[model samples]
Target: LEIQKKGNEWAVVLDSKYNRRIDANTKMEVSGAAKKEVLKDKKFAYGTFANCANGQTPWGTYISCEENFDDYFGSSDENLKFDENFKRYGFKTKSEYGWEKFDERFDLAKNLDEANRFGWIVEINPFDAKSTPIKKTALGRFKHENAEFIVEKDGLVIVYMGDDEIDEFIYKFVSKHKYVKGGDTSKILDEGTLYVGQFNGNVGDFRGSGKWIALEYGKNGLDESKGFKSQADILINTRLAA
Candidate 1:
């Protein structure tokens, strides 16, 4: 469910019996591991700038991508950093919409290091608004332009995702688990494989088809030689991952 506030506190109309008020400093329980340890206490996870998108999952969750995080994190005077990959892929370290300097947290933006906490396809159980949004790294990363789902003739599930940049690659995640008639959406999303696309051709050759490779685990991982990796890495450094 999409919720927002004009200034100060915003109320979450959870149900006919439960109407809760959440503010910039509202304590909440967000799902994530700090240095890999599971935290159970509820802490504040939202504030004034909670703009999200309009995409729903088959399992029934809302995905919110963190675009322009630099805006809330504050702006940086230090030149944006780029590597060979950036040059090969035609990306600029410099950004026109500078906002990283205003707030250091938005630099990711607050416990906004938690903002990397976001990025992965976030799963929000709109049916249960109090449910913590789960970032599905299994979805890979990039700008996460969009997630499109289509069922195959044989009843398989297929998802198409675009990176939304000049030369960024495309991605597709085929679930290891099939969609069931009455399955839990959160469980289905939490478990799946992620992949990234690799196109081979000369600078001007854009007419041929490309290949989709799994950024799988262990033997089938994404590396410098083959490209791509765990969904977490892909989600955190999506631009570079592509």
Candidate 2:
């Protein structure tokens, strides 16, 4: 999508050479720890749609979030049961969009892990039309409302996000590497610490203090005993970890 100045006013350019659309069939790469665990070296992820809100990085890149993606895939088999993790993320037995009718990847019985590939913060370089968007799973996964960034004075990037649900929580991600001007920050999102918000004090207290709980592996019992192996598992099941 492109917007350009048309003499007197700005207009949306639908047919511009730089105009691009990423639908359900677009192919993308799943980077970071998720590539090793969830994808298991199958680096590719199919498409990124159902984008509701978005944010931008200081380096002029776009982060398109995948929300309500579970409505696109499913099956009707009564015996097709899902584990606690799948049910926790709200994967249903029938899809609203009925994408499974055409793409088998949408079918739970056909590709169980395919649904896990969505609901991530996808990064795209708006300046480069040929750039392949990366799915940053380390930021954690859920029905993300948006991801806004704040560059600290020390150059550390902090991403603030919300899960856009009534009883859900807010999250933040602090980049492990500081942002250097003119340097490639594309991979920065892939390496970060994700934290969930924990508000203290009474509900009506406007002066309440909030704490950011670290959702890292081996911390707070987020380990093998809890069915999580590494930081990747904690991120992939962020809602459960929170």
Candidate 3:
């Protein structure tokens, strides 16, 4: 939807692409991952649900977050084994919305990997109504609350986002490239490192500073031994990696 400011009045109206189905293209280039891992070749998904809160990018695009997405999916067959990853993400034999009963895509028994497709921040272009919504996988996937944009003095960006679950986690994505007005801002969200927030100093105390630990794949024991096969794996299983 677009909110336009007139002389003395503000007009809020539905956009041309309002209530549109999300494009299922996974444009991110994740290499050598299993075809059955998430979406086939980590390449596609159906649609978005539970989009609770949103934010805007410095480049003026809409950031829609998926929250409580696990509620849409469930296992029709309880005999189907669920892994630790599934438990961490809060998938279950039965979901709150029971969408699995109607949509096979929501059934974990049928499409287990489909769960991984959700829970990431989806970016939509306001300028191009026909634009495909890009899932920013560089930002770790979770039950996202909202992304707060922080523009560095030098034009780089730091995106702060919370997991939106009790005692979950907070993360920040720092961009490697700088943002230039009217210049290309593609890499600002695509190429970045994610860091989980670390709180220091406490014990019934109220105020303190917090440190950030990078959730990079090869750093601090996040290797194949721990089941992190690639950067995409780290991004998919962010909570466990953290």
Candidate 4:
């Protein structure tokens, strides 16, 4: 979808050539931290279309979020084992969308890894029609509400995001590299430090200082001892790490 301004008015037009409507069946590539060893060659997965909120980058790209994605997958009564991360991310025994009725990928009982593929912040380049959207797993996955970025004076980007569910945490991603004008900002999200907020002080007093806890693997007991194999594992199960 593109918004174009004519001589006197602005109009929203569907540029089918450049505009893409990703559905449940669409396939995408997984990148960032999730591309590590355990998920190396398994970087491809089905689409993510339950976009609730979106954000844009300074380089003019779209960030599509997947919210309430768990409702699209169905469960089974065969006592199938579910990924512990699934329970933390709120996978139900029954699907609201019932997408599993048609596609077996939506059935967690059948494809356990399918559910892990969604709930990510996907980046789409509206300018390039041939470009495939990237699933930025380094930003951490959850019920992503929105992803807003603030570029500092030195060109370092700080991305602020939130988990929409009640009592959920707020997150921020700081790019490891500084942004350069006229340079490629597409891969900036691929490598970054993800942090979760922890508020202190009384509830009614808006005068509390908060801390941004780093979610990096091997830091603060986020290593294999805690069942986190790599940075990708921590990001995929961000809710549990938070």
- Index of the highest-lDDT prediction: 2
Model 2 residue 114 lDDT score: 84
User: Which candidate order results from sorting by TM-score in descending order?
Assistant: 2, 4, 3, 1
Summarize candidate 4's per-residue lDDT along 121-208 as a digit string, tens digits: 9888888777777788989889999999899999999999999999999999999988998997767898889999998876566666
lDDT of 3 at 37: 53
What are the per-residue Cα lDDT tens digits for candidate 1 across 1-242? 23457589775544433233333333333332121221223343443223334466665556554333322333243454544433333333333443444445444312324344333445555566365555555565345566777666654567777765576777887766677656644445445555778876656655665677765434344554645443344444555554
- Backbone atom clashes (below 3 Å) for every candidate: 22, 0, 0, 0
**What's the lDDT for all of these models?**
0.49, 0.85, 0.80, 0.84
Clash count (model 4, backbone only): 0
Q: What is the Cα-based lDDT of residue 52 in candidate 3?
A: 76
Candidate 2 wrong stretches, greater than 4 Å:
203-205
TM-score computed on alpha carbons, candidate 2: 0.94
